[model samples]
Target: MGLFSILNYLRLKVIVTFIRLIAKWQRRRLRAAQPGPNKKQISIPSRDPGRFIEGYLYTPPETPGSPANKKKPILVNWHGSGFVVPSLGLHDVYCARVARDSGINVLDVDYRKGPEAPFPAAVHDTEDVLKWVAGQGDQFDISRVVVSGFSAGGNLALVAASVLRSSFEELKLQIPMAIAIYPVVDITVEPAQKVVPKPIRPIPAFLARIFNDSYTPNPESRKDPRVSPALADPSSFPGTVVIVTCEGDTLAPESNALAERLKDGKRKVVHKFLEDVGHGFDDFCREGSKAWEQREAAYGLIVHTINEEFGHSG
Candidate 1:
């Protein structure tokens, strides 16, 4: 490796290690505090030999009217890790809550991350997971598949709904809706330039650089529709697009722009901006706090949007 790449790799290893440790602690605390529902650990086959996509599948409680053999729609979720840290189970609360409230099966998929897997690896993982989901017709209603994510995962959600939409046809899969919360849609812009109105907590410039470089490496690749997503063709998105942004977040503007682009009068695009909050505002926080309230509201909106799109209370 070259001098610059070597240095970048070394720094990223440190950052990723430290962040993942913290994430592990936080995940444990979250599980202890609010274990929403029981989930089954699953391993889905990946195109890569011996490499499997790991995930947790949360199935809603059986309803009286629902048939025992009936299949439920599935929501595939990817967690935000800046495309670097493998912050698995970080969205357990959100996934479990959605399954409980919406009565849909929720799959929290863990994909390969950057500095090792890089750019298209996660993207490919997204498509492959969807294919696996579609194949499980006996277990899930593939026709009603929906994709959702937070931050970096949100960008993946959009890409899965767009660039990978064609791949779904043969598998008989369809993503009717995609809920992206505080997504990073434009990586071409400098991290410092992204900060506006002063977020409650700003993403560190150095960390942002590491995330960007580790994931895409080539600055030129940052503009690829599959990478930035904001540069993608809006028609490529799902039938219903739900974008949630935090007013204090640097990513809000790009997310809003994406919502606007998806709204061609005919297509259904919903943009809900949460005021006085910042990125990752939906994460676990102290009860009764402002952030907590916002988190609840955002989760409610997500459940509501999914139900509405699926054409049922679930």
Candidate 2:
């Protein structure tokens, strides 16, 4: 490897180590406050033999008098990590809340990330996870499955919806809808070039560059639909999509553009621009703070959208 590549690799290692430590501490703190949710760690065998995708599954409390044999709808959630941070349980609390509020199973899944597996690896992992979910018809209502994600996970949500469009049909499965919050839709633009009006908590250019380089090393691949779903054909996406973008986020403009393109009259595309917040503003918020309130509102919208799509009253 070139000297620069070697240097970035080392830098990435250091950054990842620090972030992982912080995430570990945060998880412990969150757990101490209260039992966040009733969730269990589960692993699904990947397409590659011996490989596995790890995730936490949150099953909501059963409703009184509900049929014991009834299967519930499932929401497969992917946590945001800029395709670099491999903090699997980062979304534990978020996933728990969604499962309880939406009254469905929420799978906060983990995928292989960059500087290790790189592009197409995470995408393929996502596809494999869906396949596993499709096979669990006895436990979940596969026909009502929904995919949601934050940041890089948000990008995967749409990319999966577009790239796996036909395979899902062949499997006789219905994705029903997808939710992307503050997603990275276009990587063609450099991190420093992205525009944010408020710039409250924009992603640092150095970190973004590190993430981009580690995730998609080939400059040309940045235009590929898998890396930049904004360039993909809108019709390839699922029929219904709910896109949430923070007004102060650098990713908002591109995400908003994709939302607009997906609106073809027949498709149900809801783009909600949360005023004044930056990317991931809902994350790590103190209770009773403004950020916490925004977090509640965003999560509430997610529940409402899922229930509405599944024909359930919320």
Structural similarity to truth (TM-score) of each candidate: 0.94, 0.91
Q: What is the lDDT of residue 76 in candidate 1?
A: 96
Q: Over 4 Å off in model 2, which ranges?
A: 1-37
- Cα lDDT tens digits for candidate 1, 249-279: 9888888888888889867888898988898
Q: Give the TM-score of candidate 2.
A: 0.91
How high is the lDDT of residue 198 in model 1?
57
Q: What C-alpha root-mean-square deviation, in Å, does candidate 1 show against the real structure? A: 1.8
Index of the highest-lDDT prediction: 1
On TM-score, the candidate that comes out on top is: 1
Which residue pairs come into collision in candidate 2? none
User: Per-residue lDDT for 169 in model 1?
Assistant: 89
Q: Candidate 2 overall Cα lDDT vs. reference?
A: 0.83
Could you tell me how far off, in angstroms, the CA of residue 127 lies in candidate 1 after the best superposition?
A: 1.3
